[model samples]
Target: MFGMRKWNTPVLRPTAPFIIGGIAVFYLVAKAQDAMINSEEYKNDPRNPAIASGKKAH
Candidate 1:
């Protein structure tokens, strides 16, 4: 059958919706990582006193 022959191809095109969704997820994860790395709350935590004091010598 013609339909069966089409299915036998080794390469298949990705659908637009799935591609868009993957890009959105990747963007969101990158933004979250950036926010975490640059957050002031994370840098000034009392539990890590050394990090807070290290920035003051400059």
Candidate 2:
């Protein structure tokens, strides 16, 4: 067993650029969700209960 090879796995590292990109991605996703919740089709969708009270789902 000692002569056999072992699994080689890469370490997880979060660099500065990756972190900044992640933050930007999160911001864009949040903005996209906001736009979706404010869309007319979403507001009129039967599955959305908040629209019945004239309020967006947020």
Candidate 3:
């Protein structure tokens, strides 16, 4: 059969892995960004306020 499966068979679609992986990557990125934002280095960086105020940092 060309890409045909019996009604009783269970199939794992290809998008399942990609969907899970995308969620994992999103979670990790959010955690990293939170850490970076909370770090002293970020707080002391003048560019942070400047960016927030919509001013170009020199």
Question: C-alpha displacement of 49 in model 2, angstroms?
Answer: 7.4
Reference-based lDDT, each prediction: 0.63, 0.74, 0.70
Candidate 1: where is the Cα deviation over 4 Å? 1-14, 44-58
Task: In model 2, state the lDDT of residue 3.
Answer: 66
TM-score of model 1 relative to the true fold? 0.48
lDDT of 1 by residue, 1-58 (tens): 4445645654336476777889999999999875664577665555544455565321
Please report the TM-score between candidate 2 and the true structure.
0.55
Candidate 3: what lDDT? 0.70
What 10-residue stretch in candidate 3 is worst by lDDT? 49-58
lDDT of 3 by residue, 1-58 (tens): 7676566554457578988999999999999886675577775576575457765434
Return the number of clashes found in candidate 3. 0
Worst 10 residues of 1 by lDDT: 49-58
lDDT of 2 at 51: 75
